[model samples]
Target: MTAYAVAHLRPAARLDDEVFEYMERIQSTFAPYGGAFLVHGTTPEVLEGQWPGGLVVIGFPTLHDARDWYESKAYQEIAPLRTRHLAGDVILVDGVAPGYDASLTAARMREAQEA
Candidate 1:
């Protein structure tokens, strides 16, 4: 299954040299794990609620690849560059398979609740 690294980054007061450096070096860390940016800190169109900041999404070949990329030394080294300057949330999640249905999830949830 495909996996994703999703980040919701709050607005930075300023983009310092460190942040720029992190941006410059981030792509290098991805190639080893087959990670690619699906969305690179892009401002989203607000259809419903107000969006606090930009969204970043990286797609990986699988959940293991996503985990490996996040835990890899290269990424760890540059993570602080952004962490120190930005406040946000990052999570890795697996994408649903082809022909997935919400009804299947609903059935599972119903069974769990009954249990």
Candidate 2:
């Protein structure tokens, strides 16, 4: 199943020089894990309640890939920079896979009618 990491951030102070450098270096981390940024610092058109500041949505081929990227030592080292600079919510979400109608409700209903 495809997975996404949704980050809704309210910006605080800018990252320190060291942290910024670390951020720049981490780009190499994604390719190995089959992860890529879908949306990075793109301003959203808020149609609902109080809009959180910065939002980033990263995509991964699978939930495992996303987890690996998050848990990896490379990311863990710089994770604090992200937390210190932005404050809000970040979460992983699993998506439905292809051809997932396992219930076969229509077939069940048709058989019941015939019976």
Q: Residues 68-95, candidate 2, lDDT per residue (tens digit)?
A: 9989988888788666655789898997
Per-residue lDDT, model 1, residue 28, is 94
TM-score of 2: 0.75
Clashing residue pairs in all predictions, respectively, total 0, 0
Score every model by TM-score: 0.93, 0.75
Winner by lDDT: 1
Q: Model 2 misses residue 4 by how many Å?
A: 0.6
> What overall lDDT, based on C-alpha atoms, would model 1 receive against the true structure?
0.93
C-alpha lDDT of all candidate models, in order = 0.93, 0.80
The best candidate by TM-score is 1
